[model samples]
Target chain A: MDAMVEQGPEGSFVLGKVDDLLNLARKNSLWYMLFGTACCAIELMQTGGPRSDADRFGMVFRATPRQSDTLILAGTITYKMASRIRLLYEQMAEPKYVIAMGSCANTGGLFQESYAVVNGGDLFLPVDVYIPGCPPRSESLIEGLMLIQQKIEKEPWLKKAWTNTKNPKDPQIEGLL
Target chain B: MTSEALIDYVKGLLGDKTKWADPEAGDNFLTVASEDWKNICQTLATDKKCSLTYLRNFTGTDYPEDDEIELTAHTFSYSEKHGLIIKTRISREAAVCDTLSKIWPAAIWYEREIFDLLGVSFNNHPDLRRILMPEDWVGHPLRKDYKQQETYRGIPTTRPA
Candidate 1:
């Protein structure tokens, strides 16, 4: 409730500032690592530029995966690059989110035929939200981000992510599925 | 030379070597023997009056039922102002075509797409690799006999209904 210093399950410092929780969510300003690997990457860029100005949604683009809060896997993920991407996902700090943004990142798009593509980013890492489009129009990405933020706000679980220790008893993971 | 005169001139050059694929109009379609595709492409590109400079597109269409693959090489000459669609076919069992990469650099991407989507082999394409699908993807998707796919790894895929 107060500024109590709590050591989270991951052994990281967590400030249990209940009152500041809402403010924290508002100010955290999600930083997205633009993983524009294909045509969809083009639309993702539009979201951040003058047109959609995803920046308006408090989503700033970052080049470094280590410094980002969100990973926008915006294009196709080939099998060759899958391992590197997984490593990048692991490098992000705790409480990180992933946004799978496009047909290729979601379902391999039209390239599902080739022997090279990994089909989708989901094959490598868990995705928090999916914004579907051949390349979802930039508007859709903004909408998807808003929906993710809204879900985060409504779920007390998101705020208590650190407090709720993952149960080892559950052998498998549960998800939006 | 306008599009009509250029096309008329090309008609004379091919004599009996070509077929009127779409004389019904709306779309122009001409069929060239698979063996002569290279010579025709080179002639179109360097012919004195027909200097077709633009390689509009090159693509393949698959027919699983017939076990054949058809390719289209759309070329146009700016000076002559003509657009010619030279098409040919190859059996699915032998999906290899002579590479036009040396003649038109842009053919490289199209040839790669054919290789990626249709699994067609361009005998001499410098980098004959999958440009569309993942480098390790198992099967060609556009083929009519495409297999049912599920998740790539543990992640469930959104299947096309």
Candidate 2:
């Protein structure tokens, strides 16, 4: 059984530690939350859908935030839902990385002038990768996911914000409403 | 029913408050006062004959120097219903409008979005929260006068040299 295999020292040990096990968990599975809120959400769906098949890259859509390892803030974020977004970011477990997907999430795209759009997703969470577009083509989202996977492999410490944001000393920022 | 008759019927309810802006790109638009937006939306959505069951989308634009914000609500009517784009302008200073969420549940999210990005307060929206930005995000990102924040989501955004 895979569980029995995982328990074997040779299966998980790397230089006499469980580093290989950690690497295996990080590499084989990365569940993402469906946080699409706008047009970019469409493109994001396309990435995971049949045509793009992001499963090849080890990304699967997650129904709940708790189970997901990554969050894709894929759309224009407005002030009204900004707090809820922050809460969602908090709900995500440790070692989570947020990917700002599309122009709306990255820079508010065309709706940047409208009263309700959040100019950028970064204002709410630390973004590991920013995929730009009015709604970036599906290809762009794929590339962004790959790049994020690369980042996760390189610097796992980037998750510090998810924990640091909870500190009392963290600045409370203002909003439109 | 013809467009003229429908316009006339709406004129009966809104009276002098409705003005038909010239149609462009094959769509007819009507401009109404921000105060009357709720009532007008109800009439359009609930009326059995002129049932506009779908709210296509809405976006707000801020004109700071002029002290006005323009909200454009695009609605699609199922019947005789040629597409109608309703536009209403409100002064930026006291930008307040009744929430249309009561009539169209979908408007709750759209209205919240408008309030979130524009800083306009919807008088009676059931729940108002930021949709796209972080909870601690400062300032409405879309306002023309908005200043670029240096740090967003722990990412440092640099200005052009």
- Return the top candidate by DockQ: 1
Give a tens-digit lDDT track for model 2, residues B1-161: 67777667777766788888765567677998877788888888887767878888888999988889999988877666555678899998888888878887888899888887888888878998877655566888678888866654443343222
Candidate 2 has a DockQ of: 0.11
Off by over 4 Å in 1: A1-29, A35-59, A73-87, A99-124, A127-177, B158-161
Q: Give candidate 2 regions above 4 Å deviation.
A: A1-21, A156-177, B1-161
Single-chain TM-score of chain A, each candidate = 0.74, 0.78
| TM-score of the A chain in model 2 | 0.78
Write the residue-wise lDDT of candidate 1 on A1-177 in tens digits. Answer: 245667788886766645358645744487788677788888888889997888877889888888887888888877556666766766676566778888888778787765456666665567878888887998888877786676555445444554324334421212212
Candidate 2 yields a Cα-based lDDT of: 0.75
lDDT of each: 0.75, 0.75
The TM-score obtained by model 1 is 0.69
How far off is residue B51 in model 2, in Å? Answer: 13
Query: For all the predictions, what are the DockQ values?
Result: 0.21, 0.11
Candidate 1 C-alpha lDDT tens digits along B69-112:
99998888776667888899899987888999888999999999
